[model samples]
Target: MDCLAGSARAVPRWRNVAGASRTGKPVIVPGLIVANVAVFVLTVVTAGSLNRNFASPWFAEGALVPALVANGEYWRIVTSGFLHVGPLHLAFNMFALWIIGREVETVLGRARFVAVYGVSLLGGAAAVMLLSNPLGPTAGASGAVFGLMGALFVLLRRLKLPAGQVIGVIALNVVISFTIPQISWQGHLGGLVFGAAVTAALVYPGAVAQNRRRVQIVAISGLALLGLLLIGAGAAFL
Candidate 1:
């Protein structure tokens, strides 16, 4: 459900509090990659197979099933982002994660990056619950990966940087999402829309204000609350 096909050139360095220039290598990116891989390993070890089977305990317990979520297994909305149907699913998503996560984490900083990712993941689950077959379960990190891509796209545009390659990559991915069987296009679209919206909320306020950091915090919190309300409505109606 995911692929890497874009590159971003390094931006000019900004000075830190000590007046020293820093490259800002990302910590959360690697940590997220590790957590995902560990969960995949645990799934393989526990389930003893990589094939798709909803009856599999891992899928039954963790994958996003609309009915199950509506019935109070709401944790699946988040957990499903960490689960995968097979090795290739895990590999593709992890590869995409590695490609984009570092850049986004560096640009947004650790806390805001985490917020974007968490909201995007929930957005994907909410979309799946509302738009896809209620009885079918979906699992993967494609939604989160797409969300990071969307965030990067918005950041590049806001900075007035060249965004042609990023736009092309997103277009290609959207086409692939629709053409491929078993792919969750609802999740992809939902994540992209929500990611762009949340990132815009986080970054646009800084454009006109001196207290940009405080504005960003307030904007992100408002978006988070809004996302929660949307997800709650989706679950209730499902």
Candidate 2:
């Protein structure tokens, strides 16, 4: 699956859109970008080519292959998200992550943002395992980036900000996913669905302000469990 689907325009600053003070500076977003870049560099060094990192042993070990996952190499679901096919793929995905991830991190705080990102990555892998060719290897952060995009849309709607641009961007990406060969629409759609659902749980915890945190905990836990169940079921299919 191609990691760099396209450039998804960044959302306007939350403070500008929602008139709320900034909650936190972005810590996790930068860290994630660095991690992805570092992994890409290592893949290039090992493979001795910028565009052919797939030839690297790192790719062999990390890229998600459903048959291997079924054989119990379960860590591919996480590592594959960090691997990329080429420099261009890595660049585009990191750019999208910087643009979209920082805003989501600022709004959700570190712990919650990490939770959503981790689960969304797994959700994407689960979809791939369940639907894509069992022997084909897939890698990249597109799925997680798509997840962040989905989260950003939910956040904008929650703040009552104009979401026309976000909706258009998402629609455009969905179109690209279908038109472009080698793109994993299954992973993209899975991440989007799970990310939006997880963010909705966080932002829409019902009445009773004092119990909002408690409600968020329950909701996020439930979603995480659901993601795990999906992953396990996908493995069974593999």
Relative to the true structure, how large is the alpha-carbon lDDT of every model?
Answer: 0.77, 0.80
**TM-score for each model:** 0.87, 0.89
Q: What digit string (tens of lDDT, one per residue) describes model 1 on residues 94-164?
A: 99898888777766667778888987887787688878887888888899899988998887776666788
Residue-by-residue lDDT tens digits, candidate 2, 143-182? 8888988998888787666778888889999999899998
In candidate 2, position 127 carries an lDDT of: 85
Top lDDT hit: 2
- How many clashes (backbone atoms < 3 Å, residues ≥3 apart in a chain or on different chains) does model 1 have? 0
Residue pairs clashing in model 2 are none
Clashing pairs in 1: none
Residue 218 lDDT, candidate 1, scale 0-100:
78
Q: Cα lDDT for residue 8, model 1? A: 25
